[model samples]
Target: MNVSLLLILLLVGAIVTYLAGDKLASKVALFFGLASLGCTIVLLNHYNLGENISFITRWITQPNVSFALKADGLSLAMVLLTTALTPIIIFSSFGNEYKNSKAFYALILFMSFAMTGTFLASDGLLYYIFWELALIPIYFIALIWGNGDAEDRKKAVVKFFIYTLAGSLFMLVAFVYLYLKAGSFLIEDLYKLNLSSSEQLWIFLAFFLAYAIKIPLIPFHTWQANVYQKAPTVGTMLLSGIMLKMGLYSVIRWQLPLAPLAAKEYLPVLIGIGIAGVIYGSIVALRQKDLKKLLAYSSLAHVGLISAGTYTLTLDGLRGSVLQMIAHGFVVVGLFFVAEIIFRRYETRTIAEMGGIRAQTPKFTSLFLLLVLASVALPTTFNFVGEFTVLYSLSQINVWFAVLGGTTIILGAYYMLKMFQYTMLGETNKRIFADVTANEGITLVLIVAVLFFFGLYPKPIIDLITPSLEEILTQINRIN
Candidate 1:
């Protein structure tokens, strides 16, 4: 039940997949992804049997850090997310022929490793290490394998890299400050430090700068749209699906717990900024002619709501944030993949160029429509559960805030329906169209299954994360 085994599996999977050669890399990667996910399920079963799944060993004595991996309910949720999404992501790739296929598959596994490590690392320095480790793979995945002009792709990847790197530096500084104050980077140790109001404020701001840019909220979100549009669909999936959750997860795991006073003090301001992103992103999405770009802005709006939910600092908010993180991860990946499906057929991203695809490909249309409905938070979809809970949390804070944040429902519906109608409905395009292939259909089916299953029975995931959120809220309550 050792949690670090999960990391080992993924890291080893990366190397093994690389060595497996180009022709077999995709299959090897998919196998490892499934194996890694199996590990999580087994770990959960052991957890239920009351076996210890957490273990730590001192790794860097100078920094007082440990090669630690701790999986609580919350950490497991995130790890499960990484593991669950990896196979789908890889499976999505099976339909394409990526050059240097070994490297491409290997990077995907490496990313899974880093993100899983990020979720499980309890030592601040160790967590920071994993945090920065994630950027490298995605950076390459985008840079080498990206689309559009070479120079333009280079610019976008560099901007994405530099912007996120700059954010990580601030987070490192904050961790350093905390290490000085507490003399250790252990999550438990840092939590015990009694910093003054001023100290908390600066540390809060520094960490905020890091997570804000990663989450890319409001004014700080400038790097997101371009990177998303420029990168290949796999790159875009990693970016939108799971990478963004690192920031939102950090806000709950690190920012709120470590600096409760600051979180409490600035709740209003933070929620305001998050809501602003919701409005701004949704409005921008309304006008996007590019399908990928539309999904990009739509991701911005959905995450803005999730961010706002976290700042509410209520149990409902935290729970909803977690729920929505999973929901968004699943839905956004599906949406982006749908975009890829469209582009592969038409070789164009322009929405106006696509119409009435359903007549030719009813199966693809059904899957795409299900995801679009989920994106708009339709009832009986998993996203509906997350969005409703988030809006409920906001209403608890203030009716007006909920009112503002709730616009995503109307706006999300508008834009998603617009995109759906233009792409999946209306007059059939004159070009030849084929139904989803077996591999692509399997991937989409897996995704749609998750949405419907969770949409019906979200209790399992909710229960899994609740105790952890409760523990976090206990910490914030003690400080406030």
Candidate 2:
């Protein structure tokens, strides 16, 4: 089957989940989510067999945009990430009840559909459309179902919406300008343009504005911690787990290749900003009182490193970024779900209020400790594999960059381990904290298994993504 089937499956799934009624919506969404994962595995098999799976059809004649979906190793790896994590995110919400559950579940599926399309779309205009489409579901999801003071949540979500939208407009302008010059909005056509240095600089900066906001790098990341705390746990999981990766992926797929010279010229500046974000996010995370907000800043630190590695424009940088993207997705989701589990038992997000959970729930404490370890990039975890490579890439650029970026590991362990001591150790809490339920256990176990399995033997993934990274690296160096 062609890649369009993947989008069709999720889009149709959204509609079906909504119509299935509130009582059945979660189950329906899960079914479709698993089906999408299975379909991706099948497609990956076909891709490995050297079969053509990308789909394209003309959609606009005047502006030369096409309804296109391209499935190469890079896009497919991301697509797989979206599909694989979606079901886990959905299932993790099983224990919690929501008002208008059907609409909530439907929106979750719809967001998945949009993100998948963003990863696969080949036409710049189409990719931009899919990219913007993703913002809609999360907006409503956070606004309606989110926690905290209604007014506060509204302000946070709206601010996030505006920041990302304004940044994205710059990117749309860049694409439109490229279309005018090349008479086409397909990625290949835009990449072929031999623009002057000035033109490439503007385009690169425009795209960087869009991506940096979405990735929520330093200064641009003001909206992140508040929104993550305000949104419901499910929404937070989707945002941290898969949505932000869209920005990092675009940096590799769209930004650099389209403006290779600009990317090269600004390499030091870009990497500097990224490393700054790493130091900044980690320091901020160490001071957070709210569990979700801490995780949010932690996310910022990790993505910052990923962005820095990508800006290095080396194959190792690209590959490490991609690997870290996937590893971070799984680990962040697990960590957020851990926060949710704690909130369910204690009915609070304050780390100060939580304590002595290890006395009551050994299973949960063990699992939570595992997630924390993974987040800190412990050896034999998938995060370690990715972080090591990213640091190596930075060292290749400049040893000092590696030295600064490595602060994430040191600061990460300190904050995370310290948070664990306060939240799970110390005097026994007066309130009861039950062990994880079967559903919760399943979700945590699945994520942990994937992290460890890949950590020890990352060759398969390394092999899968290497060739595509090589191509992007070639494009990056083409103008040099």
Candidate 3:
């Protein structure tokens, strides 16, 4: 019944899967992933029934730290997203064989465990620990099993690692300063602080430095494309699907709540930056020949819109951001898998090298088209719901913001369709482009089903996340 059980399941799963050997590793990893999903569902039921699911115990009394895990609707929703996607990402890698399958699969589970903990931890110090822990597995995943030349992959992975780790230290310093003032590292305790405007601004900027690089907003995003282009498809999926959400999620969970005034003071600039990223990402994506690089830039754009929505500090904005986060997570993963599918067949990610795939693999072409449409935020797809709400929120803040941000859909459609036309249409490729296997089809189907179903009826998610967003808003407005 405790929230920690979710973390335990993922961690235990990682250990057991690692020990299970290469032959059984993938299966065991999938089993644990599904089990974690089940556990999250059960926790959701318990939370709905008004039971105490959050767990807290003192871990380091000196610094006032605790091993605490909170399962509010917001955290639970994120945990659900992590658990649900972990298995899908794991399962999608079935077609490719790695040299050390056990280690590869184990790192996936371990990363999931760290990410789940990051979502659930209620104590600031504990949250930071989980946040940093999530970085290690992904670093190894991209460095060891990643694609491209050894020196190139090493440079890309190392640059990403150093870039993110350096940004995180600023966050750690902020936490240390906050702990000094508040004498506690618990979220509620930190929220109670009534710091000066300048103090709050400094704290806010420090956190922003970390989140910006992680979310890779604008200039901070220099490391993103290289890393995404070089990482293995599974590594790419984890980064785009779930890891980047950590930065967006932290904006809500940590930055704004901790420094509401700073968020308010810098709202326009922050939103402008996000909108800029949207336009930038879309335009960059349009020119990329490599499919993974295109998708990576495409992610930068989608998340930029999501970030702008979150910075708006309205319920609709927050709700839209959360919805988009979930929608984007599923859809992006599906899209990357589509890229991987083509790579598996063609042995290349170059868009020009691919063509007439539609004539060869009707089923894959159909699913890939659906994912492309979803990326463009087409109506009756899950992405549409989030995109609409986000735009609406921006319009409320300033019509200009909405106008600028709306370009994502238009620009998104242009690039996505062009990529599709070049990669999937035209004369048949001389190489044999096989139809999707059952595993691949199942993954795309599951992703599409969730997107479309939620697109039609988004109320459940809206309802689930509203109260939590409202509380965060309350904390935000308490001083303002």
Candidate 4:
């Protein structure tokens, strides 16, 4: 079947499942998830030999908008990630006996559709529409299914919603300005326009605010930890695992090449913020007692490295950023899932409340240990590969920057191990805790296998992304 047809079918299936009610809702959603995965695999197979797929239909003519979707190596990779993980996330939700099962399953599938659209959108307006569209399901997901004080979750969700919407309005204005100047909303048209340096700077700042808020770098990151802490584990997984990459991806696709000189001029300041976020996030994470909050801060630190790498504008830096994004997505999701398991058993997220978990749950201990090692960038884990590449790229920019940035590894190990020792090792408290179930074990072991596989063989991913990265760099160089 055609890819677009498959996408439409997935949405339709979701709607149908949502109406099907509790008894069959989850099963129907699972079927759609598996079907989407199958379609994604077929799309990947076809694209492996170098093919491009695009579908466009006119939506508006006054400002010249179209519902345009295009898939290249990058888009396909993101689609695969979205589709592959959606099933696992759906499966993960099996453990929760939600009140409105149909609505819960429906939201998961709808989120899949929005994410797919975000990656495949080729028109600037269409991209923005999908970008904002992706946030709605998540907002409801967090508000309805989240843990913690109901009022706290409500407040956090509102803050997250407002911050993202406010930033995106800036992006909308920037896109409209580009549309006025370039006379087209198509990405390629915007890419071809030659804006004056002054204009580019303003436009770049507008785009930067939009993406930055989503990435939630530094001062803009206040909403993230609280949201992650309050949101359901599945919601947190979707936000951190796939949603955050949207911002980083846009930086590469829209910011750098579109406003090359501004990017170059602003590179140092951006890198400074990135480095600061890395240290600040790590330090703050050191003090977090809640596992989810700690993971959120660690995520900030990791993405800070990614942001810094992107500003370097070197091949190694860009490549590493992309690789790091994929690595971080997997590792963070796994870490949060482990957190969920612990919370389920202990009925608390505070690390101090738990002790000697490994003694009671050897399997959980083994998985948690692997996740910590990956978090700390141990050799032969995907995180190691990404961190090594990023630091290598940073060293080329400045040895000192690399040295400072490299401290994250030590700091990361310190906090992660400290948390582990406090929770997983040491003397048993004589409090009985359930071991990891077969389902949780399956999810974690699968992630670990993928982590190891990618670490050992990153060449394929590098090869797939190289052509696109080189094309992007060439564009930036031309404008520079």
Q: Would you list the C-alpha lDDT of every candidate in the order shown? A: 0.92, 0.94, 0.94, 0.87
> What global local distance difference test value does model 1 have?
0.92
Residue pairs with colliding backbones in model 3 are: none
Instruction: Please write out the lDDT profile of model 1 over residues 163-219, one tens digit for every residue.
Output: 989888988999998998888888999888888888888888999999999997989
Runs in model 1 with CA error above 4 Å? Answer: none
| Per-model TM-score on C-alpha atoms | 0.99, 0.99, 0.99, 0.97
> At residue 353, what lDDT does model 4 achieve?
91
Error of 3 at 18 (Å): 0.9
In model 4, the clashing pairs are none
- Write one digit per residue (lDDT tens) for candidate 4, span 1-480: 255765796788779889999888988998899889998888877778666666788899998998888777777777877887878777766766787989988988888888888888889999999899889999999999999889989999999999999999999999999999988899888989888899989989999999888987888899999999999999999999889888988898888988988998888888888888899999999999898999999999999988888889888998898888888888898999988888887788998898899889898899889989988889999888878998999899889889888979999999999998998999996778888788898889988887889989988788877888898899899875
Backbone clashes (count) for model 1: 0
Steric clashes per prediction? 0, 0, 0, 0
Q: Candidate 1, 53: how far from true, in Å?
A: 1.0
Candidate 1: residue 298 Cα off by (Å): 0.1
Off by over 4 Å in 3: none
